[model samples]
Target chain A: MHIPDGFLNIPVSAGAAALSIGAVSLAVKKVQKTIEDRLVPLMGVLAAFIFAAQMFNFPVAGGTSGHLLGGMLAVVVVGPWAAMIVLTCVLIVQCLLFQDGGLLALGANVLNMAVIGVLCGWVAKKATNFLSRTAAIFIGSWISVVAAAAAAAAEMAISDTAPFATVLVAMVSVHAIIGTGEGVITILVVSFLKRVKPEIVEDGACRAL
Target chain B: MKNRKFIVFSLLACAAVVVFAAVFASSYPDGLEQVASKMGFENKMSGINLMGAPMPDYGLALFGAGPFSTLVAGLSGLAAVFLATTASGWAIKRLRRSGNG
Candidate 1:
């Protein structure tokens, strides 16, 4: 769901860019009152983990492989605001280093994948926690990925990159499955971290999980 | 663990993980690329001419993966995390200090 360069028109991209920046700023403000110094490095480490995890592409149905976007993983491991910063770092590195995404389209990519993905993923996790872990992770990840994809597809549609319905279907349907991978990976990683460093969660340093 | 020292250790540990990730990453086309290939847009994929970028294709434009590629991508990811997190932390700190929290 990383919208490469030239996928969206300049105006639509710029609009989404502004929204992303605004959301990040708001996230920082929201977390500042509660953020402790100890959480900073935790967030950074989680970001790096996300960066690495994103490199491993899992095979989806139809022989296509999709990697963990880590928006949910980061949020689950850290808080949402810090996750934003963390995932932003991952996105920037992936784009500049791997040529996997575009430099000019960084704003749109972050908005869709980092901002929308983390926020929606966190909400979905919270909503589904009443169910089993498997169900929670599966549904949470599915919703987040589909939401991000839908947002990206909307941007593309508004930008006239592809027909609205085509982009929506292509992105949402595929990402629906991709979200399952995301959910499982997120739950496993968070569970591992919780076992190793329970204090991070016990102390309220990690909230999104 | 003290806060400052823990942070340093976490950073180093993340750097190590990045190396592992780059090395162990599957060498296959990702979801988008696969979809594009199947959907007939694969031919439209074009290389960007970004000047002097490091570690293109996770391998500095080299053909195959190796320790060098892994190390480079790992280090780059580490640097990015450091820069972004530090900047964000400082910003948060500054905002708090300004009584704007």
Candidate 2:
């Protein structure tokens, strides 16, 4: 979710921005340390795909719509570090070019999706691989969306944009359904990639499918 | 599939989504927006975009709000994201090379 400016006060926004900057910088370093040759163009296409996928907001329930956040999807293709960079770039482009997100809240959005979302998804995938490959990716992806929404809700609540309990409940509940859609999309794409180009789906999770 | 072919396929998929979104993206407010509206804090969104993006909400302001405008804007965004990430990846790889050398 791209947070708007007024949702957070200056301090919270700045704090999130600082943390986001650190995370992005670390991501850059990690990618530099060891990046695969194929990943160069692969990252390009994945970024484009994620950006495009976010455009179609399918209606969910109660007059709410949801779109593919793509953090977990990107992570399944690339590792967490590169996924962060990819997501940060997407968020930045959305804010600067499309104005989809508030410029002042860019850092917070990046923190929520690029940093927290990717890592949570990666951890979930890694932990649950024993269950089944597809299941792990699905569960991991669902968690990523919920984690990002939770983080966003926490930020707004802390900012007094809304009541903490209610914001958390509302955001989480809506996103839980949205996250399933995310999982389905992720599974569809990852499965397609795994079938088409087995090596490309690094998955970064243990166990082979 | 070759890496080259896969790249082409994915790019085509990206373009397909953009065009699809141009024609049929849902207008409903998303989860956060829905929550904000229900909670009566949607007004909290200042909606002040510091950087006036040429294409706000995937439609070019210069052009009338139409499917074609969205198609143009979406393609532009897809290209922008593709190039930005590609450049970043290249820069990182180059830096790594020089560091190791």
Query: Candidate 1 — which residues are off by over 4 angstroms?
Result: A202-209, B1-20, B42-46, B50-52, B61-67
- Per-model clash counts, in order, read 0, 0
Model 1 chain A, TM-score vs. native: 0.91
Give per-residue lDDT, candidate 2, residue A151: 98
Residue B56 shift from truth in candidate 1, angstroms: 2.4
- Model 2: residue B91 alpha-carbon error in angstroms: 1.1
Clashing pairs in 2: none
Candidate 1 structure quality by residue, lDDT tens digits, A1-209: 56666666779878887988898888888777777666666666677667766666666787667878888666655666777877777787778766667666778888988899888877887887788655766676778788888887788678765677876788788888888888787777667666666566432456422
DockQ list for all candidates: 0.45, 0.79
Residues A102-186, model 2: lDDT tens digits:
9999999999999999999989998999999899999999999999999999999999899999999999999999999999999
* Candidate 2: stretches off by over 4 Å: A202-209
Give the best candidate by DockQ.
Answer: 2
| TM-score of candidate 1 versus the correct structure, residues matched by position | 0.85
